[model samples]
Target: MAMTSLPSLPLLPLLLFAIAANVALGATIVKTLPGFEGELPFTLETGYVSVDDSELFYYFIESQSNPKEDPIMLWYSGGPGCSAFNGLIFEIGPLAFNITDYEGGVPSLQYYPYSWSKSTSILFVDAPVGTGFSYSKTQAGWYTSDTKSAWQTYQFLRKWLIEHPQYLKLQLFIGVDSYSGISGSIVVQNIVEGNEAGVVPRLNLKGYILGCPRIDATINDNSKLIFSHRIGLVSDDIYEAAKKYCNGSYDDVTTSEPKCYEAIKVYDRLIKDINKYDTLEPKCTWASPNQEEDMSRRALEETSSDDFILSPPKIPDMWCHNFNYAMSYWWANDRSVQEALGVRLGIVDNWERCNKSLQYTLDVSSVLDYHKNLSKMGLQVLVYNGDHDLTIPCTGTQKWVKALNLTIVNDWRPWIVDGQIAGYTIKYSESGYRLTYASVLGAGHSPQEYKRRVCYEMFNRFIHYYPI
Candidate 1:
């Protein structure tokens, strides 16, 4: 035994090897979390990093793991002026709507014991400065109403990724809805091409998933036709009515016009009772104060309409008033969001008053060229729709998709997940990439509100290759 213990190995080499192994293991553990800089409810960390002097504001949500092994998911809301926080609270996050107390002063919250965070880290971003909590103090500010603003957004996100290198190897997926469809596509295209060309700091982007994305403005315009066709409004009479009264020919129609107003009047009357038997509350139901205020405003508008008299109230009106006060208060309080995004006040008379200028700014046509450029860049574009959405209907979305003229990879067919009608999907493949069209069932503009589980399942399957 004494003879066997004669020779001793060097301790230093063993110690060095152990240290190196531990370091590598630690890096592997950390790489799982992409952009998580620190603890949750964190304040915005702002900095200037790009050539355009673009500023970025970002916060981190702590991972669930002592050593988390979940991929990060970046989330954005639409509006071009809205906040991602809204999506976080209302959609897939831990907290969700608890509408048990319908008559309560404020809505209640219920925690989702099981959520996407079970396998993924979520990053809800206020993009383009003017949205959510991200803001800039410059004169141009955070008002991103154009493609240039989108470029700035790319720069900001690129820099943010660079500043946090731990996310370099983490898989990235851009998730958004509505207007963010355009924004997400633009950002993803930039990231993908930039990485390929070794142009800017790169991100390991996997793919993108959208819900009720508004991809094409022209198609959206044609959606009126599609809806009319689906609902038996294809007659020559309705067609003439639409063109004459809906201001279908107007270059700019967001402003109130006799034709558009009359058309909407007819459209509203037609769909008013379509879902009467559903027993579901009005999608746009507002509080008592809002109802009273809306009634007062409508009364005034009706009184002034001598030429085209708005019919007297029939059934008790649902107070679907605009959230002007809430929007204004949000903008005023979030100076960062306003300044960085250049959200102009007084440009429109009121927050609720539909602004022709704003509508024009949000026009999908404004970004059509960018979309073409993206398509050329080997990107897979998907635009989904919601059939029952009054805000952005499926017909409108289909009209927009058809305008793209991308090669259809998958034929138009019903996308049946369970035993119910989940909506339909059309797939397009061009330049070795695939784009998809998915529609949600019984969903409004915000499909997640109505079909949260199914929507999440679809996205999960699309991005993560998992059956949810």
Candidate 2:
């Protein structure tokens, strides 16, 4: 029932920094989380790292595994716009929102047993200037591209390390999911380049971790047809016709391919019935017209206005699948939660799970080359995809990895959890660099959320440099 609150810090105006440079180094130690019981078991530090005119926010959790010697991972959630908190509460963080008990009112919070923090320290960061509680002091700082964003994130980590020098010796890894796979590699490249250039307070860089990374739009887009056919969503005739008419390249469709277009139309109509993220996950029944205006604050104010349906779970076990996300909208937006997080008052008017306001520019087309460069650098890499995910099909990731042509250290084999096959894995090596490719069987876009226990088993082994 007891909680600790960060002291109120006045908002820094546009020119406020001219008065104090250390003002940007704002940080607060959280002893208790909003819906959590008792004191936090792990050290929770919420703070900002000033980068040029942008102030990036981050949540730091000390390792439950072995803080002294265990590795620390810097996480960037995908979406190119989704907040790192999504990665925290929904996937790898220590606590998850208890959306299952909600008939109405606040969503409760509970400790998650399968958090990656159990194996290593984790830093959930809000990057690219306009994500989560991160904000830009200057107008020009608000707009960013892939390359520019990586630079900013790199600088943010460097400064954060400089402030927390005790963590300088811990092995570091850049981790992310979804679209971040594109930028995550670039961020790692930036760190690798910085370390090579002899940057001060050097990082003990190890490797990177990716979850259903969206590296190439064209590659992933084309893989869907293949994925759909392989998963039995489309019949053999439909698959063959698409391959025959489209010439196996579905990345870009020609206006002349009428039969290809017809086949795609049929595919779209059929696939619409299933949840695109995971074919097995049930589709949300959209809120009815009469209940449209009668929605929760999370639904009305913070839930993304994207076309996807935002409904409470119909089944008990699936209650928190996406509904727990609604709690984020409510919790983060609450003035009390903001104060607990040490918000800069008026500096952040509101927080979106994924900031829809970012003027993000996706300039870097593909990170395949970035991965290629890292592959030669002798770093350890882990790339895992949910086999059921349609967003960035495993086939697309396989497409790029096969292109790398690394020697197979371990042939593809079924990975077991509790003595039962959970998914599949293959190991590749070249010039001391080792890469592991894993398929999270039957899971969705974010396997960490869909199958936490199995993912934790896989993560524990990977972080410890053991076989999964």
Candidate 3:
């Protein structure tokens, strides 16, 4: 098949069936990996869901406890471009790179005790079109916008479920780390609509989970200034000046009044030395001048390859977090690792954690309306933020959640784990809709990367309908 053009709407289902009729459902049951020793304890399945001319790759791990009854969550890493391996290895998955012991050639992997998959089956997908192992047969297929990406993902899920009918009855929840929330919300809403429209296999749509998500680009970026001031990164004098001159909006100071522009320049200088992702971490020296400029913008308006700084510095202890990201490059690029994972030969060259170079357009500025629509549907939601993350500050999350105007059911209180405060949380409800909001104490962007155990505890409680 040429796959020269995308399948038309009328012919998409037939195309899906045609692809599924072939053996194996385009999936591979990965028994062993290059760095991990022995057979994997849980079922690890990797596959490509053919969505028209695009091959969306995914890694599905069965629940460690009981896949038969537990909820199934479909997760994708943000950057709209970051590889799903980021979620699989760094954040919520069972395997993690042993960065501390790395003398490095195909970094060693160790089992993470706090993986969310311990309780729920998780499907981690490389989305949009050109992320990770996912690829497009035609140049046109590689191009995607927020609306198109969401639609493609919805199609991917339906086709995937069709191939694995055992999971058809499982309650489905969408989980997104960072930026994917825009599309994730759209995907959830799409799932609901598809079910109501009597779309095949009727997805048991539940709700969604968003971690330090980018909701409104302007609002999120502007919140960074407030977050920085609140966290003591900006001096009171400077913050006050900026607040007064910038008129409470620091996102586009360049075109603002002269005083406002000057105030913002000072504010930016104050924060220039700090690692905005996690204010507690040291600034990365490995980032190029261009990457630093990109970081300075604090905008999530467009996907860029610079989203993740790939190279690890020689001195690991200085910036251990970014150093850890480098392990994925080392591991994924290895011939043995690719062979073990059943990666198609030569489809992708030099795997990137986030391939922002793909032709992508950020069409949706804010998904707040989508959230409002979902709120009326009687679904549940869990929204979390790392208290110290300036990238998409907790303050911004609070502002938007408050906009929903759901009655506060459970007043704000400290949520505990091991008898110590893990974070603060509040619950809101209206009609049948319920939303839980949390802030992970002292963590940064993507709480799971910094507080895996705490995040797992929070997720465990939320998934089981227990209060957090």
Candidate 4:
């Protein structure tokens, strides 16, 4: 891998301006990290790609298998504000925090065996100019919306590919989880349009993969009632009352008719304490009042850390699934950890896992139109969800997929792993486009966090064009 010069392409003017502006744009081959031992087993490159006044950070990991020929995936986490660590460390990346051994100081690091990078390269990005180590040079850059984030991601990918031309010929795929589904669709559509317009360094855009996707706000908001009833969280009578009174509109129950409002009020009270991300998981209370206040503002369910506690309780009192999220907060904030990852000092004051204070606007309410257009482009797609996820219910995903009206290539059936039923799946196709939908049985919001091994197997098969 050379850090020599940009290829003689149409990117000269932008490249010249980037060089003159003293932009932080270079990749560091991080042989070691603060918590990991000795040297990394895999090739780890950390760097920043300049997008206007925003310097978006990314961690690029080569595949453990055939790196030269394997597919490359650009992964984005949800929250419209959550860090990409939500994808890298927690979901599918190889390195993860050693949560059980943590007592104080920097959290220890351990390798995750079922990382998606085992079969494909992944660029886990801290995007939209305020998440993770990514920061904006100007105050205006701090303000971003759904459309702006999507275009910026396209800009970052173009600039990144110009720097590392080796991956330019490999198949490129956009992989997103949770709320990123909105922007991820836009990014893919943008790439397709760029290629059509003869853009420089044309991306090898094959398709995209989405997990527990948040497609339409109204659909996702309304499906919670169905999910709750199916999972036995709400009684049949209560569910029926809300369904009849609400009359299919469930986004804001308070603003509806009196009977509808009352029905939703009772519905809310029944499941108020349940973790929306995973109904089976206990809702851990946030440690501080400020953190609680922060959580309250995320009414749109844009965040992926709905079940996290600011301060992790004693592991002995009761084990928590979200303690790993807390451990990451302490680990990322450490100075040594920052230095190890080549983070520019003084640019960011605090490193939050999900910074709700960002000046973000939800401009794009629904991206089903993008999907409809992409379906005509003849691209391969995989849309999956966790059966237990309520935040972005699988039922909502099913409704949108059904709306596409693609031919059923494969009927609904159970997919197996280790001779056991992992989940159910169905396949759809229109023209040359293929979309396969699956559910990770009993998994939560982000299925990889709840069922790592099962997800890795499913991903490996999908990327290789094998049956899942």
How many steric overlaps are in each model, in order? 14, 0, 0, 0
Looking at model 2, report the run of 10 residues with the lowest lDDT sum.
287-296
- Cα lDDT of model 2 by residue, 1-468, tens digit: 111221233432322333234533468888986777789888888988888899899999999867888899999887666789988888888888876566555566888878899879898899867778888887777878788888888878877775676677889988988878887888898888777765554679998899999887778889998998999999999889888888877755656788887777777787888877888877753211111132112211344345233445555454324656666777888787788888777777767777554677778778888888888897988999999998889999999998898999899999999989999999999999999999998899788878888888888889888997
Q: After superposition, how far is residue 104 of candidate 1 from its true place, in Å?
A: 7.6
Question: Which tens-of-lDDT digit does each residue in 105-131 have in candidate 1?
Answer: 233344553345545566666565534
Q: Give residue 2's lDDT in candidate 2 (0 to 100).
A: 16
lDDT of each: 0.49, 0.78, 0.82, 0.82
TM-score of each: 0.63, 0.88, 0.90, 0.91
List the pairs of residues colliding in candidate 2: none
* Superposed model 2: Cα runs more than 4 Å off: 1-25, 285-320
Clashing pairs in 3: none
Ordered list by TM-score, greatest first: 4, 3, 2, 1
Q: Compose the digit string of candidate 4's lDDT tens values, residues 1-468.
A: 111233457666576456535433456778998888889999988889888889999999999999999999999888877889878898899988877667688888988889899999999898777888888888778888888999999889887776676788999999998888999889999998888866666789999999998888888889988888988988999888888888887767675389999888888888888877787887765311221133323221223455365444355666556777777777887888888888887677567777776677778889999998899987889999999887889999999999888999999999999999999999999999999999999899889889988999999889999989
List model 3 lDDT by residue over 1-468, tens digit each.
Answer: 111233455775675566567527457889999889899888999988888789999999999998999999999988767889989998999999886677758899988889999999999999987888998888678778788888888888887887776787888999997888899888998888777766666789888899999888777878888888888888999989988888888876675389999988888888888877788987763211221133222111223345445334456445546677767777888989888887887888677776646567778889998888888988889999999887789999998899888999999999999999999999999999999999999898789989999999999999999999
